[model samples]
Target: MCACKAASVTIVDGLKAAETKEKCPLCREARVYEGALHMEELNILLSRRCPEYWGERLQHERIERIRQAKEHWDSVCRAFMGV
Candidate 1:
C-alpha cells in the first residue's frame, strides 16, 4: 500500500462517508472530500492488498455497504482469480 498523501486525504466525513466523492456526492454537484487525518487511513491502505474502505469517516450504513462490497469482491476474486 502506498503511504497516505496527507494533502489528498479525505476526512470531512459526510452522511455516507464515501472514500471518493464519486461514491457519495454531496450538495448535488459540489463534492467535498473528508479531511486529511480521516482520509489518511484510506489513502495509505488503498494500495495494500485490501481493495479499499471508507476508513473512520464512514457511517454505520456506509460501513455495511463497504463491508458487503469487500466481502463480495473477496469471494469473487478469491474464487476466480485465486488471489
Candidate 2:
C-alpha cells in the first residue's frame, strides 16, 4: 500500500480518538499533527522511484520530438524552394 493510504489510516485513527475524547496513539508515535500526515505522504511520493524504463522512455520521446521537428522544418524549406 502507498504511504498516502498509511497516512490516511493514521488520520482516521486520530479522528477516532478525537471522537472518543482520547489521546491519539498514532499522533503520539509519529509526533506530528494530523494534517502533517499529508506531508508524510508527499515525502513518500517524492522518495519513490519511477519504473526502470521511465527515464529511457522520456529520453526517447525527446529525441523523437527533435527528429520530427527537424523533418517538418526540412519539408517546409523544400516547399518554399519549390522542390
Candidate 3:
C-alpha cells in the first residue's frame, strides 16, 4: 500500500523499529531469499514470479516514456523560442 512499493529498501530505522519479516509489496508473500543483483545490500527482492512486479515495471516504463516525450517537447519549444 506504500507509494514506494516498487523501490528497494536499504534498511532505514525510523521512529519505529524496522520490520523483521520481509514480504512482497503486492502479493504479500514472504521473500525468503536475497536478489542476485543485491550484493547483500538491499533488503527487498522483486521476483519475476510476482505478477505485480511486472505490472509495476510496465507502469514505470510508461511513465518514463511520458517523461521523455515531455523533455522532447520542452527542447523543441526552447529551440523555437531561440532561448
Candidate 4:
C-alpha cells in the first residue's frame, strides 16, 4: 500500500467516491462501483448500526479536528477489522 494520504481528495470527492468502490489501501485499487462508505456517512451509518459509546466529554478546539482524528481512527479500525 502507498503511504499516501487522501486529504487532497477533498470531502466532496470522498462523498462522490462513496457511490463507487472505495480507494483501498491494501490493493490500492481505484476501482469504481456503488456503495462505498465515506468517512462522514460511514460514521453516521456506524453510529446507527453500532453501539453508542459517548462516555466521556470531548474538548476539541473544533469539530473538524475531532473529525480528522476519527477519520484516522476509522482507517486503522478498517485495517484491523478487515472491513
lDDT of 1 by residue, 10-80 (tens): 22223234444432222333343344245456546754644445344245446555766687778998989
User: What is the RMSD, in Å, between candidate 1 and the native fold over all Cα?
Assistant: 12.6
Candidate 2 lDDT over residue span 1-83, tens digit each: 12223334332233222222333345534533345436556535644665545566556656755766687789999999999
Task: Give the lowest summed-lDDT range of ten residues in model 4.
Answer: 52-61
Task: Tell me model 4's lDDT, rounded to 2 decimals.
Answer: 0.46
TM-score of each: 0.28, 0.39, 0.39, 0.30
Total backbone clashes of model 1? 6
- The TM-score of candidate 4 is 0.30
* Cα misplacement distance, residue 22 of candidate 4 (Å): 8.2
lDDT by residue (tens digit), candidate 3, 9-72: 3222121232435555677666422342342233234444666885786577568657666877
Instruction: Give the Cα RMSD of candidate 3.
Output: 11.3
- Model 2 residue-pair collision total: 0
Clashes of 4: 2
Task: Looking at model 2, report the run of 10 residues with the lowest lDDT sum.
Answer: 11-20
* Model 2: lDDT to the true structure: 0.48
Considering only N, C-alpha and C atoms within 3 Å, which residue pairs clash in candidate 4? 20-33, 21-33
Please, what is the whole-model Cα lDDT of each candidate in the order they appear? 0.44, 0.48, 0.48, 0.46
Instruction: State residue 42's C-alpha deviation in candidate 3, in Å.
Output: 25
Give the better candidate number (2 or 4) by TM-score: 2
